[model samples]
Target chain A: MMAARRGRSAGLIRLALYGIGLVPAVVSFVLGATNRLGADPVNTFERTLGLWALRFLILSLCITPLRDLTGVNLVRYRRAVGLLAFWYALFHLSAYVALDQGFDLHTLLADVTTRPFIILGMVAFTILSALAATSNGWAIRRLGRRWKALHRWVYAAAICAAIHFILSFKVIRVETLLYGLVVAALLAFRVYRAAPRRAKAPPV
Target chain B: AVDLAAQPGPLSGEGLKPTPLRDVTHYNNFYEFGLEKTDPAERSGDFHPRPWTVRVEGMVAKPRTYDIDALLGRKLEERIYRMRCVEAWSMVIPWIGFALRDLLAEVEPLGSAKYVAFESVVRPSEMPGQGGVLPVLDWPYVEGLRLDEAMHPLTILAVGLYGQTLPNQNGAPVRLVVPWKYGFKGIKSIVRIRLTDRQPRTSWNVRAPDEYGFYANVNPAVDHPRWSQASERPIGAGGGFFGASRQLTLPFNGYGEQVAGLYAGMDLRRDF
Candidate 1:
């Protein structure tokens, strides 16, 4: 009975995670539809989705650290958080293509290839798409150990996302700086955790 | 707010629709107040623009400071201009002011004077953005124009917009308006107007020389380093649905007929 109750609570927590994760996208849509977004509604909407994508990506990265540091295991919900990040990123790119670029494939292609920041963001998104595609139980079971290796690219995606965020603005805003710092901290923690393991590995 | 009285000028926006007054006043890039579009409207409450004085000096025959009220006494005209920002946004504003040449004429720029530099007011106490630990751009925002550009009839010192006193966020009391150039060239809250022999350094150019050049003319051909300048989103148009709000950015902001002669033999690609 205790095990069943624990499983039920975990399921509820996962459901809650998804519920909260989707709020920003819904709110942004409603705001855009209602003309409540500020003067530059399209830019505001696009930025809102991009910001949430980066936040979710960071949150997904924090799962392992939080479990190891505090003994609060949230491993079951990590996939949900990662999928949320992918969905937000997809929406962000769609908004840019539809609203900002006016479905101008020529300009979109030019932006993705030429603009350094846009290129970085697209690179991150590409990696996210691959990871997201293989995030199901069947793929995980089939790929086995390779799944862990492929999913590890999330760090690279997070770093690219952080740099892309920083480069989007002309000036270094405090909020951007804070987000960059968090990503940097998370990356540093990953390196710190990996150092001892690498040192302990037997020679091939 | 007291309304500003002015006669209609020769230049008119007859067919063009002026951006909604709400968007015009609410969205701004006055770094003195803050960086965000809404920051100026929200944070400019403490700013005081009255009882201001603009000091005219440097390479001019008659160097004298003019009081803001005295300057307002001059003949003001309502001129509708389409202002394009370097960030690919545009707005049509109905401004009330006299030609900048009229003010320059009063000071009598010397034969050696080839450029006109404008400096904005800076008060950290009233402007919170100026008091930040690390500033985004140099304080006392500065801008410059070639003597010919400054003397152009299209250039005016705007004191009001939409037939009313300019709001604090919109560069209250006084501001520069160069219709053919990017909006950043329109420096605000004039504290000093100096005539110089060589080209004066502009704030944005000083910050990012490669991206924002000295001659920030609105040319669609020359793209900003990061984004295309081919089109601009018209503020307060079509509710930004399906990218329907975008319009092709015209060369020299569609004022080329009147201002293109100023750049006669110069290569805009290099000057830009």
Candidate 2:
């Protein structure tokens, strides 16, 4: 009975996470519709979407550390959090394409190829897309052990996204410092977690 | 509302509609206040724009200090200029000011004066960004222009916008407006105008020489190392979902006919 109750609660929390995840986009839409996004609404809209994507990506990274450091197990919701990040990233890219670039193929190609920051952003987005595609039960069963190996690329995607955020701004503000520091800390924890186990037993 | 509705001034903005007054006052890049677009308008309430004085010295004949009232005595002409920021956004502003050449004539610049250096005010108590812990930029922002560029007919010492006294967030009291250059070249809240023999140190160029240059004329061909300069979105152009579509940026910001001769044989790519 306790196990069943706990599972139901976890499922409810997962549903809550999805509901909360969409608030930023809904708020952005309402603000845009009401003309409350200040003077440059389109730029504001584009940047807000990108900012939320970063936030969700960082939140998804926190799940593993949360489980390990504390006894709280929220593993079931990790996929939901991660897919939220992917969807937000998709919206961000769509804003850049439809609003910022006006679907100008020439400019889009040039930006993706020549701009270092844009290149990094695209790299991160590509990884997220692959992860999201294989997140289903059927794909996980088909890929078997390789699924774990493939999903590890999220670390690379997170690093690229952090660097991309840093490079996109003209000046380094406090928010940039905070985001960079958080990502650095999370990645450091991963390294520290792996180093002790590796020292105990070397891989053949 | 009444101020913006005044009669058209001596110069026109080529029939381009002025950006809404709300956007003009609220959205700004005044780092003295903060980095956010709305920070300037929100945080500059404590700033006092009155009781100002500008000192004109260094390589000038008279080297006189003019009170703000004296500077305001000159006949103000409204010239609608399309202000393009280096960040790839723009606004059509109806600026009210007299020719900068008129102000320079009063100072009587010496033959040796090849450049004009401008210095902004320093008031950390009032301007919170100046007191920021990180010090993103050096205090008391500075800018410069070639002597000929300063004396160009299009350049002006703007004291007002939309027929009213300049707002604190929009470089109150006095500021420089060079239509051809990117908006950073148009320094704000100027407290000092120094004439020099060599090129003067500008704030942005001093911070990042590779990204910003002394002569920052707007050219679509020259891309900022991080982003393209080929196009810009005019603020308040289209009021809907996507806002305004990006319009191609023009050489000399479409003032090439008036200012291109200023850079005759010089290569813009190198100077930029």
Candidate 3:
């Protein structure tokens, strides 16, 4: 009975966290729709959504370090964070397509093809969407060990996102550089933590 | 300070100055307010220019403070001048104002005065962008030019535009309008003018000295670190329509005839 109650409580806690995670994305969408954003509103909306999407992705990536340090048992929350990041990323891309480009698929395709930065951003979003699609428990059970391999693409997505930001600005502002550095440090921590465990294991 | 009052009347006539109409009316580089090319108009409108006084001091024979109204009392001349931004955009504005030479003469520069530095008014209440978390500049924007550049006949201290009083966003009441060189060289809503022997540090040059030099001459060949400076889009062009765009930007914004002698024998690439 106690175990069942704990499971129910965990489920409730996750639902709350999921709702909280959607706030930024919801607010950004409402602001974009209401035209509350200042002049060049479309660009403003696109940039704001894109930045928040990247921030959530970064936060999702930091969960492992956070859980390891705090021993908070936060692993159960990883799927929620990853899914929210993907949702925000979808909104970010949609803003770019529907608002900025007015759903001009030809222009959009041309932009992705012509601009290396846009291509990088598109590739990152595509990888994120694929990961988000396979995040459910059913897919996890079906894929078994292959699920972890597929999820590793999140690292590639983060790298691509950082590159997308650097190449997007005509003049490189220090803010973008700092974001790149933080993402690099997070990835480095993951690699460092994994290397020792692999080295200690008997030849596999 | 040299006495600007004794100088001859500000230059007049279309031939004596560039034709204001044929001149491009679109290029500008004032970024304190925002980043878009048209951002200055939207962001700068909120700037209130009342009860403003410019402090004129340093190496001049006399230091004086003049209110905006008194400064505008001087004869206003409309000279259509071509303005080229360092970011590769150009405009022709029919600027209304007296020459900077006239204003400098009022301050009375002494023999030691070799350069003139100007400062913009920086108040958070008036400039909303000043409240930004990041340091866009060291507040009270600054621009400087060699004494010769300051004295150039083409250098006008603008007071109005479009035959009307200057709009607040366009640096109303008083602003420096240097036809040659990049638009940033023309500091806006000036509140201070100091004549000094040493070269004064300019805002952009101080912020990123490697990118923006003290001279800041409009050289098509000298590219800004991030973008090419070889060409510019004229203002009012249809969202960068091809045929309507201006040809290659001229050196010193094509005011070489009036101001080129000032930099004679100097390496423009190094000085720029």
Candidate 4:
């Protein structure tokens, strides 16, 4: 009975987290479509989406740390949350292509080539794409042991995303520092949690 | 409320689309209020621009402070200038003001003066962003122009924009308007003008000397460390979103004909 109740609550939590995760991106799109995004609405829309994508990527990284450190497990919804990050990142790129750059291939190429931040963002997106493509149960079962190893690269994606944020701004603000610190702490926690396990195992 | 047709302009912005007041007032980079575009407009509503005073000092025969109203009493003309930001966006604004020389003439700058430094008014209460978590640059922003650039007829201390008294977001009662340089060179909410032989240390140049120079002439050939400057999105051109249209950025923001004589053989690529 307790297991059933736990399952029910987990389902609700999954639905709730997914619903919450979608709010900013949807609001940005709604604002853009309605022409209510103020002056430079295109930039507003694109930046808002990009920020949320970075935020979601950060939150997705936090989940494992939260479970390990605090015993508050949201593991059931982690996949969906991870997927939301990908969705936001996808929209962010789409906004840049369709709205900000206006399908100008030359400008887009210039941006990707000249800006190191853009290059880092592209790398992060590629990593997220790979993880997203193999997220389903079918891919999970088919790939077997390799799937977990592949998905673990999300950590690398988070680092790239954080670096992208740092490099993107002309002036790196305190918010960027704070975000960087959070990513660092999350990675540190992973290393801490792995240390004892590594101590017990044979040396690789 | 006045008609656009009656406004005296094209001394700078000829054949360029004027950025609407909505975009002008809303889309800003006034770090005093905030780095974000909307921060100044929303936050500056209560900012008291009236009862302001400007002090002209340093190497001048006579230094004095004049009330804002007294300065505005001079013959003011409307100049539609194309303002380009270092961030690679551009705007054509109808600025109303008299030549900076008129103001400088009143003070009688001494022969020792080779550069004129401009400083913005810094108040934590008035400028909401200063106390914020991450202010972009130092307070009471300072910018300098070479004496020749300062004495240029086109260099005006703008008092109004779009034929209306300047909004608080647009620098309120007083601001410097240098047409050829990037927008940051036009330090806003000005309170102090200093004439000196030594080159003045500007806020952005002090912050990142490698990135922002004292003479921030708009040069398309030179790219900012992070971005391209070859093309720009004029604010009103409907090019910002999904990039529909982008015009090539002009040398010295198309004021090269008027101001290139000032740079005269200086490599803007290195100087930039």
Instruction: Find the candidate with the highest lDDT and give its number.
Output: 1
* lDDT per residue as tens, model 1, A104-164: 8777777787888899899899999999999999999999999999999999999999989
- All candidates' TM-scores? 0.96, 0.95, 0.62, 0.89
Model 4, which residues run further than 4 Å from truth? A1-20, A197-204, B1-12, B236-244
- Candidate 3 reaches a DockQ of 0.05
Per-residue alpha-carbon lDDT of candidate 4 for residues B3-30, written as tens digits (9 for 90 to 100): 2222474475667668877889888888
Candidate 1 wrongly placed segments (more than 4 Å): A197-204, B238-244
- Docking quality of model 3: it rates as incorrect
Per-residue lDDT of candidate 2, residues A1-204 (tens digit): 999999899889989988999999989877876667778877888888888888989998999999999978778998999999999999999988988878888878888999899999999999999999999999999999999999999999899998888887878878888898999999999999987553455567
Task: Kindly state the fnat score of candidate 2.
Answer: 0.41
In the range B215-249, model 3's lDDT, one tens digit per residue, is 99998877775545665545443321122333577
**Predictions' DockQ, in order:** 0.49, 0.52, 0.05, 0.36
lDDT to native, each model: 0.90, 0.88, 0.74, 0.84
Cα misplacement distance, residue A150 of candidate 3 (Å): 13
Candidate 2: which docking quality band? medium
Q: What is the alpha-carbon lDDT for the whole of candidate 4? A: 0.84
What ranking emerges by DockQ with the best candidate at the front? 2, 1, 4, 3
- Compared with the true structure, what per-residue lDDT tens digits does model 2 show for residues B135-173? 778878999999999998899988888888789999988
Which one wins on DockQ? 2
Worst-scoring 10-residue span by lDDT in model 1 chain B = B237-246
